[model samples]
Structures are given as structure tokens and as C-alpha cells.
Target: MPRAVVRQRDARHPALPRRAPTPPWTRWAAPVLLAVTVVVQVATPRTLDLSFLLAAVPPLAALAYGPAATALLGGTVLLLLELPHYDLGHPGESDTATVAFVAALSVLFAAVRSRRDAQLVSVRTVAEAAQFAVLPPLPEHVGPVRCAGLYRAAQRGTLVGGDLFDVRRGPRGVRALVGDVQGHGLAAVGTVAALIGAFREAALDQRDLVGVAARLDRRLVIDAEDAGIAETEMAESAGDTGAAGTAGTAGAAGGAGHGEPAELFATAVLLEFAADADELRVVSCGHPPPLLLRGGTVTELAVSPGAPLGLGLAGVAPPEQTAVGLRPGDWILTVTDGVTEARDASGAFYPLTARLAALTEVRQRDPAALADAIWKDLVRFSGGVRDDVALLVFAWER
Candidate 1:
């Protein structure tokens, strides 16, 4: 949920969010504005006044810095306002009045800025709490496997996104899941919650991994019905935003009712690692296959894919379960499309297998190291990414 876990040779979970640094332009603009104001006032004589220009500095400063910094810059602008008129002998009260007004305006802007910052902090706190409650953190060690997970949202400044992963220890060994909802933002978040809840309950209640997928599919169908009813009520109370983009598609899925195209669906991979660390059992539903790192070679498991969850229809044939051998020091890396689909500036997709193979020496036998290696490599390869990414790594160690 925090979107980062330690990675690498010494990698730890990703760092927490911090205060954004002030931009360079803001720093230089304030001084440049003040100097220009002084020069114009000195050159123009009394008729063409430029003291008014000094007022612009404080607002610019407010946008760039905190209350203290803005106030200091504002005070400097006010004091400088009278300098050009200084050599001209005692100045008019108009100049004095302009200085006072700029000071007051600066203080007002700072106050407004502080209030907005507080509101943002409040919102972020609530969102983080919701993410923790729904997704939580995966255990570093589950039964016989050493595990780690990471999630990164496509949208900057947000913690959680549409991608999700979870691991649970049950009577049957260890059950894990990684999923990506169809869209992003609050709706995708809601869908993630629905699917994860269904998985947890079903993982324990159902004996097989495919049964877990089926249970999640059925839960989403019901959630779609509930969303439709809610939207209908909302539409009656107020006009709905037209369905056009992702939101429209999602709304259609939820509101389509009985005989229509229900919107909510997700792609997920269900996993079970045996207590003896012999193999990894996989059931993929329209999700990418987990990669295997064994004997200095990286390979993608040959798991048969099934339909995505939430169509209200079963897999034409029961989902195939594939078991990839996991000897000591072997690693299985599961990921969402965000990784495979990440494209570079030239539009070429990331070569996940080749890249992982290249890192064989450094990442071998270490799940976290392998995961971090891939994540950093992907970032560099893609320049930047534009979708939610979720990664889970498991190492079999005797």
C-alpha cells in the first residue's frame, strides 16, 4: 500500500513521500521582478510610475515558498519600493500606500496557501488509511518462502493505485494474489477492495486456486449490480457525467443491469507456494505469467491464461494450474502488465525476460534483489511509466 518496499543489494522498501522542493524559477523571478520595478521607477520620472509593478513580487513568492519565505520576500519588496524614490527627496503617500497594500496582499496569499496545504495533508492521511485497511503489507516471510512486494501508482503524489497484491498463510500452505483493476482512481480502488476481499475469504473457504478466481469473479458481478443501483439513484438526484473515457466504461459496467454489459472486471494471478519449497502453483486470469529465475537462466512460466474475472461466465474450461519447479535459490516474480507494457521513448516495450536474464549474477537466489533490479531497470528503460505497477517476488530457500 505504501507503494515501496526495500529493494536490491541493499535496497529497502521505496522511500516515503516528502515535501517537494521549490522550483528554481520561483527563486529567481522574485528578485528579477524587484530589480525591474526599481529600474522602471527610476527611469520613468513621476508621470510614468512603475511602483505598481513591485506588487507582483509577493504573489509570485507566495506560489513558490512557504508562509515564512513568502513573508520575508514580501517585506523585502515593500522596503525596496521606496528606494528608487529615495534620491528624489521625500516621496508621495501614494508610494507608502502601495507598499502597505502589497504587504497585506502577501500575508493574505500566505494564509490561503497554508489552509490549502493543511487540506491536502488531511486528504492524504485518509487515503493512506484506506489503502492500509484494504491492501495491508505482505509478510516478508510466509511459510517456506521469502517474499516482498511493491506497488507504484501512475499518478504522481498518490500512494495507492489500481494495481494490488496480497499474501496469506492458510491451512493449505501460502496463497498470494496480484491483480490490476480495469481503470484508475477511486473506482479502480473500489474494485481492488472488492476483489481482494473476495480473494481473502475465498482463499480460505475454497480448497483450490481456480476456485478462488471463480469466487472473485462472482463477487465482482454482485458489486457491479450494486454500483448500477447506486448510479441509477445518483442519476435521479443529479445529472451524470457522460460516459466516454475510462470512467464512462466503468460506469457502464456497473450500471448495465441484468442482460447488459456489466463493467467491473480485473486481471489477476493466483499463486500457492508449497510448504516444502518444491514448486509454485499458478492460475492466471488474463494476467502476465510469473517469471522463473533458475540456474542462471530466467524463464516465464508456461501457465495457461483464462478470461478476466467478472464476466459472470466461467473459464470455458476450468482454469489450468501449472506448477513450476522451485529448487533452493530459485525465484518466481509475478507482475501486472504495467511492467511488460512500459514503453520507451521509441515505443518499444520493455524486454523483461532479456533484462532479467542479464541480471542473473546479481539477482540470483534473492527475491528482493531481483525485484529491485527489475524495477530500477524498467524505470531506466522506459524513461518514465504511465500506468499502475504491482510486483511480487518469492524466493525458495531451504
Candidate 2:
């Protein structure tokens, strides 16, 4: 047996690295500002004592250079301030004391900022852990399909985001969900956690695709009530709320009217691959369609869009399942808007289909290889991704 070499490609947009401590250019900012202030003071008609501007340098240095750099900057500013006194042959007693005070204050500022940076690092670590718990690693193999996925947060130093994807083996088949909550940060992540959690449980218990979709709707309604959103249960329980954001009954997931916290809504796609059938069942909830590649040709599955999740199911028709033929050697690619909406320097959107069309034969044969190729190509297309990206690639091998 020969070993299959899978090239590690950029799977999802890479995690945003923590911002480096003060940049090199900013290190000289205080000094430059100090010099300009002194020049203006010396050249002014009223001989304005702009030396007070020197007070700002210590705080600036503390933010940009930390304690050691601030100490050095403090010394320099003191020296510069004293030079004029030396020329006048009248070095004032209060001026010397004031310079010493500024030096001490700079050290204090530096210490405070250093502490805050450490706290920030701790917060990021905890967030990453929480995200992992919400969207644990998916199995490399799901029944007869080989699968791979990636997720990247839009904000630097953040691990969890509104974008989410999950795969589970249910009674019906191997079910998968990919969705994007309508916001960012902790709030969006909370909604993501809620949605994925509901889907995982529903995938196993629900007999039909519509049943699973209904379960998700009910779960989001429960979440909305717990959060004390403005919309009462009366409207939702009565089946009067209309679809919100992209779809679903409004206020069921988190849709509040104007002046309240904007309700949470998510675009999603649910897929099931039954072992007994040679086809795939899809229910789109106002999400971007999945792309299918076979024989080196790519086609976007055309699904009539349904309401997004979080909207209650009252009066809403059951989601129609679109069954697409699935054959051996075919690949299914699912992505959040982050991938399709990514833009380049020219403001042109990423050409996902064209790039996938260009994939080499070797890359198309292996699921991992295919993922790597798409990620690398997407990175090159977007320069750097500005939003969170989540992608799921599956190859039918049975």
C-alpha cells in the first residue's frame, strides 16, 4: 500500500495573529511630536511655553514602548526641556521637579498597559477553548464520504465566531449543517452554539428533513425567550410573526423591533447523504448554495431559498428537500458568505467556481488535497480575508 501525501494547505482563513506590541514607526512618534512642539514654542511671537506639550510624550512612550522605553524617553524630554534654561542661565527649581514627576508617571502608565495586555491574552485563550467545545473536530471519514473543514475568525486574536459547520451520523444518514449568524463576537458565537447544538440533537431524533428544521426553529424560540427579547411569546405562539432578515418568522430566533438589541438570525443549509440512496437531500435556509464538482466540472446546486433560522415556523411552509444525484468521485463544497463575499484589492469578489474549475486532477481525487487547493487559491484571491470563513468539503467514495 502506498502512503497518500496530503499537502497542508490553508484550510480556512488563517487565525488572526495577536497584534504585535507597539510598532517600530510609533516608537519615534513621541520624540517627533516633542521636537515639533519645542520648535513652535521657540519660534512663536509670544514665546508660548509649549513645553507643556512635552507632558504628553511620557504617556505616548508608555503606550508605544513600555516601561524601559518610557524611562529613556522621559530622560530625553527632561534634557530637552532643561536646555533652554541652561542657555538663559536661570534653571528653575520647580522645572526640575516637574521633569522628575513626568518620569515617574511614565513608568506608572507603562505598568498599567502591560497588565491590560496580559489580561487580553488570557481572554483570547478562554474564547478559543469555548469555540472548540461548540464546534468540535469533525471525523475525517463519515460513512462513505471523506470530509474536511476549516474556520477562521474575522477579528484578530478571536477563535470563536458567528460562522459554524457540523457533521453528524443520524438515523436517516450523514447529516451536515453550515450556517452564519447575522453578527459577530460573543453574541454571534452564542447564537452559533445554540444553532449547532440544536441541529446535532435534531439530526438523530427527527424522521424527516422538515422535522429537523422545525426542531431548530423551536430551539431558537426558546433561546429568544430566555434572553428577554422585546417580542413577546404571544406573537410567535400565535404564528403571526413574518420572516426576518433573510428568512424564518421574525423574533423567533432573536429578531427584536427597532430600538432593541437586533435579533439574531442565520442563513443555513442542511444536507443528508443516506447510504441506501445515490443522491443527496438538501434544505437551504436562505444560505448560499453548495457547489458540486464531478469529472472536473463544477455546478452550484439550485435550491429554492427558505427562511433563515431563528424565525418561528408558524405559517411558514416546510422546507422543500432538493435531491441531487451523488455519484462516486463527486465532491461537494459548502462555504459561508465569508468565502464567496471575499474581495480583492480591486474590490472584485473571489471567483470560487473558476478557481475550483482550475484544480488539478491530483487535487480533485483526495478530499484533503482538494481542501488545501481551495484554501490556498482563496487566500491568494482575497489577499487577506476580512471576515470569518468556514468551509466543508466532502468526497463521495462509496
Candidate 3:
């Protein structure tokens, strides 16, 4: 049976657990705040000592009811409770002063909350956009190979992380690459972007996978060094003055200088599927070996194991290219450590090869169905992912 068809069938057979519902507290914050206000009122102080607690109520209410309702509730609470505590030097004077202070404070709190909410929304939007642009959607098919991929960042609201994968049909054949930067977040994303760009450019220009890998390594190192120089200059400028900028500058310098070489380096596997020759070639750099699944058996391809790119290691031998003849209906699966390393509640790693073999026996050679079965087993094995997992499967059809 084709892996794609098997994956599609498995996707329809619900396997994973359903997501839990959001808690009541997240839905009804205003009532919670009102209850807190009652408790505070019971324990109120005789003097203006209640000012701090009263001031806190508006922000809490805002979190529950939103800005406008928060302001209204806050204003009403102040008028009913705090107004009587104020002394009137003249007619309507006390009322005017209390109302003025409450209104001002309420508006200030609401404005701050509104601004924060807007900023959060903006960040989420940008993150999603970046993720979509950087991580292009996986193609349904490539040559005789059926391909599917998934990436999930460990951090919430962050779409793109340090992981990346690219598959393209070229003159050489169908080439695919999956890589992970040493760290996470924006800095790692920058390296991923640079590496992916270099890979695409070099892959087209160079027939050798090793050449493509080297080109990407050089690009990443150059970018890392440039960032380091900028940080050093900022540090020196700050040192000349005793301003608060000095601390920030020093921290930046420390982070850039003392950062691990791995943070600058990337682990990758580049694969080439020559459909005409019916062979698969691979080059690995400190990355997990690609698994070749055929006839219900899985084998890790042999490749020269070398240091991850951008470690600045000299005299290191270049990676060796390994090739394997593909049988009809054979499929190659490559993934980052995120898959095998995913742990369950008992801290046991997912047995990817074993699971793949099991699923292969049960499902037909449908690409989609195979992908679905593999992902379901992955989720079940890991219990849940602690980091992002990226998988690329390529199969030869007849």
C-alpha cells in the first residue's frame, strides 16, 4: 500500500485525545473580581489606607470585563464606597474631586490594558505571518515521491522556531533538506532563514549536496560574526559612559560573545532522490540519519557523519555521500531529533523505527495514509511533544 493512502485513512480514524476545555476563570473574571472586592470591603481600614486595594480593583475588573466595563464598574465602586470617605470643604467639592481622581485612574488603567492587548495581537499576527512565509506549506507530491511535513514551535504564540525543511524538484532530481539551529526564537530563526536561502541557491548551482551544505555553513558563520561585531561596538560605546545603557550593552556583548558555537551552527540532512536512477543519496552533518522504509523494513542510510555546520572547526573532513538503490514503492523518511527524542510521561523516547514498521504492516502504500499513521503513532508515543518535530517522507511509485 502507498504511504499517502495509508496516512489519509489513518487520519480519518480518530486516535489522539481530544483537547480539554478552557477553565471557567478564563471566561468569567468580572464575577471573581467582585467577590474579591467584597472580601476587601469586609476587611477595610478606617483611614485612606484602603486606597491601594481600591486602586487595584480596576485593573482586575478590566482583565475580566474588558476596558469599558472595567472603567464603568470601577467608577461605580468608587462612587458608592470611597466617595463617602472624602471630606467636603464646600458644596459638591468632595464629589467633584473623588470623581475626577477615579475617572483619571480608570482611564489610565484601561488605556494601558488596551495598549498591551493590541501589542499582543500584533505580535501574534506577525509571528503567524512569518511562520507561513518562512515555512512554505509542504507539497502534496514531488516526482515519484509523496511528501508531508509538520512543524510546531515549543513556545506559544511563536510560529517559527529554529527548525526548517525544504524540498524542491530540480535538474539533479528531487532534493530535500531538514535542519535545526542550536537555539530557539528570533535569533535562531535568523540563522534558519539564512541557511535555507543559501541551501536553495546553492542546491540549484551545485550538483553535490556537500557543496550546498558548505555554502550554507559559510553564510551562517558570516552572519554570526557580523552580529558579534555589532554587539562589541555597542558595548564599547556604552563603556565610555556611565549611563543605564552600559548595562544593556554589556549584556548584549556577553550573550553574543559567550554564546555556544552550536547556537551559530546547524544540524542538517540533505537528501537527493534520483528517480531515473532509482537511487537515494544523503549527506548528514551531526544530524539524525534518514530512515529508508521498504517492504516493512526500515534502515538508516549510511552517510559521512561530520560536525554541524558553522562550528568553525578546521581540518575537519568533508562529509561523504552515501547512496542506496530504491526498490519500487520504497519510501525514505527523514526527521530531526524532535521526533525520536519526544518523551512520554515515563520519560521513554518514541521508538520511531519500530512504530513505522508496525504501521507499515497495517496500512497500505498510500502516502497520505502512511503519513497519518506515522504522526498518530508519534503523538501517542511522545504522549505530547516538548519541542517542534519536522518529518519529510519521500517514496518511489513504480
| TM-score versus the correct structure, for each prediction | 0.78, 0.65, 0.68
Q: Write the per-residue lDDT of candidate 1 for residues 154-173, one digit (tens) a residue.
A: 76655567988888875567
Cα lDDT, all candidates? 0.74, 0.75, 0.68
Model 1 TM-score relative to the real fold: 0.78
Report the number of the highest-TM-score candidate: 1
The alpha-carbon deviation from the true structure for residue 19 of candidate 3, after best TM-score superposition, in angstroms, is: 18
Model 2 lDDT tens row, 170-197? 8878899998988865568888888888
User: Which portions of model 1 miss their true places by more than 4 Å?
Assistant: 1-61, 64-90, 232-261, 313-316
Ranking of predictions according to lDDT: 2, 1, 3
Cα deviation of 329 in candidate 1 (Å)?
0.9
